[model samples]
Target: MRQRVQIEGRQLEVSNLDKVLFPEVGFTKAQVIDYYVRIAPVLLPHVAQRPVTFTRWPSGVDGQAFFEKNSARHAPEWVRSVTVPSPGSSRGRETLDMVLLSAVPDLAWSANLAALEVHVPQWQVDGAGVAQLPDLLVLDLDPGPGTGVVECAEVAHRLRDQLVADGLDPVVKTSGSKGLQVYAPIECADREHPSRYAKALAQELTRQTPEEVVWRMEKALRPGKVLVDWSQNNTAKTTVAPYSLRARPLATVSTPLRWAEVDALRGGADPESVRFRTDDVLTRVAEHGDLFDVADRTRAVLPAV
Candidate 1:
């Protein structure tokens, strides 16, 4: 099934509206497009200025999925994009032309392709289309065996305290899968500072609680502890954008949270309470706006490490 729709003065022809993308919850391609369309007001700001790498699930979550970074080939001419240096390009291309989903129509177009996940770097592009210094620092709290969202919340609180002490205001969000991510707005002079600061902070946390936290990614060392994944702060790496839907069995979203919610989770709230789906997130934005807005508006320098 396909339909023609007008969004933000652009015409988009979306297909497979009845195709099931999340069989567990009966979510269809239409629902996916609708979610992105309705959530565009809040979702576009954080992603508009940066190049996006979409994770496409054309055959649904139960089937094969792939990441699409160079999208200029098939993107509509009306859809804007940016060209940025790609140092790790295996294709031998010096730069990648990535999609910039700056408008509601862009979201609809991507969703029509079954792109369930949207990922972007911490930095935005300058006026001349060059990559700028990272504007935020992130720490992915990945729980190992015997630990889960509750454990991640506990670590997030600790990270919040340390980030606060370092003069940076931090926020927390669910990873939309199995963990949590802590992000703090930052002002840095170069590209490497966010990654360095995140690594140093994770090391400090590990030092303070080696029994509960592990900074390294070794699978053997992860049992019963949360891994502070500081590597996502790298300029070349991308974190899942807040409010973007995860390609999980239940259509969970990488929803942002208030500090109070994090406190409640650590205070014994059910882990399922933090797993928000498409409708739940729409309701949240209606009531609370974007909880992750601070990450876009506030900036504090990364204290010398």
Candidate 2:
């Protein structure tokens, strides 16, 4: 049976199929409740009006649409989405979708999500015309157990600087878990192009941070450091769908964090040490633009490789 539960006044539907998908991830409902309580404040503002869904699959939550839909609503003027064929082979598999949120609009504070839904009749997917998508692109910087938040933040700061130097605008947000996310806006292009641009940016960022960050594309080489994955930029790749409950059994989510909280974690604080409600960081961003503006200062040294 599918059950609908409310968190922070938002309603979510969870299906029994979700439990069947992950029997080993083991997390109690109480733990999942705690996780939601912790992440809601920081993540809500970025995706308040967007419709989101959670997938209880064994692999992970499907976050592409969550990001796409929300980015469309908050920053549509600058971002867009591209639809592609679903990659799964099973009969009746859901159609695969991808989006691009652009940040190149000339207008000030006008970046909103621009979306494109591809019709996959053969796959039973319906197309929605250019509409609002989400504005957040998260690079979950998961460093191993021994790596602290400071080390991760230092690397995140460096990565943001590298992206800005490449002529891309990036913002830093704490993952509210063990790592950080360096989000950049995709401006003035369709979905396909932004994915390409994001991939280029990810690759270049990893190349510049060989000591602290490891590009996950090379699995054999990523033994002990942070994984700077470019695959997420691929149209087919999916992330933790925003607002979706993670299969962490306890329902931990991919929530956002405040800069101060991020700094606290960097200083050896626990991941749960700080909690933010939705839009709290966005409010801060509104007051002080782009947390990762150092990118503007170091542009000459790190030209897009």
Candidate 3:
């Protein structure tokens, strides 16, 4: 059975099944509720009006089990599952409830699915379409386990400033996990091209912060600090499906944040540290709409590339 948990005036339904899922990842019911409250707004726009499937599992299921189920299924277009893998596993297992599934528009879906395959190989795609992916791309800056929020925000700010200097409008958002996602739109005829653009942008960020961040493409030599993943740009790479539930211990929803909050959170404030009862963040997004100024950025960067 599912019960309603209210966060910041938003209502979300949590299933009895979630009790099993939560403990496996070290989250309590209230924390789970808090996560949804904070992230739902960010995810809503990407998943708006789309049909999705929720993948669930019992608490004791191991990572291998989680991986097999997802790899074996023919999920709907809009459905993806999140997983909570066991710690210390070299090959990350697909823990249940770690991914989100959605039926994105054909163009965006095709592009995103292609991207997903590149970034995460465990996922499977069941359908195809001729739609093009969005030119707005994101380069996720993931701070490793021990890093703090201040460092994350500083890197994000620097990256954004660099984009602006380069004549692109870059926007920032919280991953609702451990890091920040910097997004910028590009002018591309199809999804394949955006990955290359995103990679170039990531290279620039890494060059600026060689001490703090390492791009994932150089995997064997990863510095074990933060990772600047350009793979999200790959036409076959997939990000947390917008609105797809994450396998966070508290089941945090990967949501978007405003620029001011992004700035504030960088200085020790928690960007993903939000509650369902807080209207402050949602109010800010309502005022700002989406973060990337696509038209301006595209015009500036496309010609140079």
List where candidate 2 sits over 4 angstroms from the true fold.
Answer: 1-53, 57-84, 88-137, 144-149, 164-177, 188-190, 267-305
Candidate 1: tens digits of C-alpha lDDT, residues 117-209: 999999998867888888889999999999999999999999999889888888888999999999988999688888788888889899999
Each prediction's whole-model lDDT (CA)? 0.91, 0.42, 0.48
Q: Which stretches in model 1 have alpha-carbon errors above 4 Å?
A: 295-297
Which has the higher lDDT value, candidate number 1 or candidate number 3?
1
lDDT of 2 by residue, 228-288 (tens): 5555543334454333243342334343444565566657787554333324434454565
Ten-residue segment with the worst summed lDDT in candidate 3? 110-119
1-305 per-residue lDDT for model 3 (tens digits): 75654433434444543344445555443343343444444544453322222333334223211322233143333434433332233245544332332322221222222111111221222233222445556778777655655567777787777677767666665565677777765555554565666677667767876777777655554544567777766543346544334555554444455567667876667544542122444454567654433334454443234
Among these predictions, the greatest TM-score belongs to: 1
Q: Give every collision pair in model 1.
A: none
TM-score of 2: 0.51
> What residue runs in model 3 are displaced by over 4 Å at the alpha carbon?
1-19, 24-44, 48-128, 218-220, 265-304
> Listing every candidate in turn, what is its Cα RMSD in Å to the true structure after a full C-alpha superposition?
1.2, 10.9, 9.2
**What 10-residue stretch in candidate 1 is worst by lDDT?**
83-92
Candidate 2 vs candidate 3: the TM-score winner is 3
